[model samples]
Target: MPVSQQRPLTFFGVAFAFLATMLGTTLPTPLYPLYQTQFGFSQLIITVIFAAYAVGVIAALLVTGRWSDQLGRRPILLGGLFAAMISDAVFLQADGLGAMLAGRVLSGLSAGVFTGTATVAVMELAPSYLKRHAALAATAANMGGLGLGPVVAGLCSRYLPDPLWLPYLLHLGLAGLAMLAIWQAPETVTRPERIRLRLQRLSVPTEVRAVFVPAAIAGFAGFSVLGFFTATAPAFMGRIMDVSNLLAIGVVAGLPFFASTVGQLAQERVPLSYRLPLGCVILLLGVVAIGAGIALASLTWFVCGAVVAGIGQGIAFRAGLGEVVAASPLTRRAEVTSSFFVVAYVAISLPVVGIGVTARLIGLQATGEIFAALVALLVLMALVLLRRQRRPVMP
Candidate 1:
């Protein structure tokens, strides 16, 4: 099809594709226990495997994060879908640790490509009148997709024929459809006659530093809450609370993401000055609740904590993204956005590994309590910093 003649892609279409790829990233969440049983791995190994996804994400973000800006959004989106397909294939064929690691890394690569590019694409494609609505759609797609993965996998695991195999197969099919839709979708970036791709170093420019620093820190803390949930919540449920049902675990694990979506939607009403710091305060409460849940051995408290954290994360992450995007020059949007994600992913990856190693030594309950306390402290500090800094004007 000719470039201009191609059917225009709606915001929803782009958001759906984004959702599918993100969904694939977390589809294995509920299946972690099954993998542990089949492969005979320790809790520490499980976290290490999970962190492999983060490694791939950081690698891709550092290298090709700006490619979409130069090459065009359509190609990067398609590439992400293809990477997700490959990741799904690896999971379907996975029989051991190596396969699992390879699959997660591929999934991370897909996510890294999609994260910033898709968000930008959705915003660009939306009708100017609906820009705010488009932003919410993109946020929902990113976080909501993540939230759905575990639920889908958990249900499939509980009621379907093959728990591990079926979830990936379903995602593979969705990914294929997403690819087809995006292939027909219009490209938003103007193509240069000659493309020059280069490895972009990761750095936040001085102009954006004021907004980026606090926003990134808030992102890190918000994702830390998510990291703890996706990586360790299931184990906590099974090992500590004696809740062995995959479906239940999936719902609990998925709650934060769903709540995050709600929080993002609610951000439209919140004043800019209050959004970041208030979010941190909410996050602090959520983490404290999680600690109480762990210390008291109450599933109710844990689930409550997940919901509260999700809300806080959603609000803070959206505000941070908005601030970064608004503050960035048009030409550097992809790179700046990716930098924001780098901080967030680091929060997601490292803390889980810390918890994993610590869990092995001090026991899961104690480790969780300690992790929660530390995260709470981080959030408190972020809140203080955000409160002191001059608020950036929203575009």
Candidate 2:
């Protein structure tokens, strides 16, 4: 269909596609323990396997993050779906660490393509009056889909016949459906009569740096908390709290994301000047709560901390994204957004890897304390920056 033709349901269809792709990316979170047992790998190996996905994400962000601007949203989204399907296939046949790592890399590629493109596509497809609503829908789809992945996998793994095989198979089926949605959805990008693709370097404009830096920092801190829960919280729950139920583990791991969704929704009402700093303060409190939970080994404290931290992350991420997106010109929006994601993914990968290594050295509990303390410190720094920026100019 031509870009001019519009479908009323197109917005929802694209959002669903976003949800499906993200679901595939995080489907393995609750199943990591099973992979460890089957493949006989250490915690560090587990984190390495997880980090492989982030590596792929970073590569894709640097290479093709802005391609959607030239090629159109539907094609990039379809390509993402295809990559996700391949990742699912790898997981279905995964026999060892290498296979799992490959699957993660492929999944990351799919996510990297989808992240900025899907958000923009959804916003563009919305009726002029509903752009803000579309933004929320897109954000919800991103975080909600990620949050749902573990729940779906955990439920299937706990109750179904084939734990590991079932989740991937189901995700593959979802990917197929998402592909169909993209096929029918209207293209949001305007195509030139003749197209020439060129390598686009990842660069953030100087004009956007002030807003981008603090927002990116807040995103880094928020995503770090998410990374810890998704990558290591399952293991922590099993080893520290003696909670081995797959469903329980998945729910606890997903809490931060769920809370993040709530936080984002809440941010829409807050004044922009106050939102970022306020988010940082909440994030600091959440991190402290998590540390206390770890120190005491209390499930209640941990879960509570997850909820609090998630809310903070959600608020800060939305505020940061809003600032960066607002600061960028339309021509550079996708590149800038992708740059933001690069920072967020690095935060996701490095901190988790650090925890994995530190856990090996200092033990999980102590590692949790250290991670919490460091993240809290980062949030504080972000908070200070936002507050300083907010101060009235003394003429």
Task: Pick the lDDT winner.
Answer: 2
Top-scoring candidate (TM-score) = 2
Instruction: Give the root-mean-square deviation of each candidate in angstroms.
Output: 3.2, 2.1
lDDT of 1 by residue, 253-325 (tens): 8999999999888877999878877788788889899999999999999999999999999889888888888
Give the Cα lDDT of each candidate: 0.87, 0.88
Q: Which ten residues in a row have the lowest lDDT in candidate 2?
A: 1-10
Regions more than 4 Å wrong, model 1: 1-10, 127-130, 206-210, 325-335, 390-395
For residues 228-262, what per-residue lDDT tens digits would candidate 2 score against the true structure? Answer: 99899888889988889999888888889999999
- TM per candidate comes to 0.93, 0.94
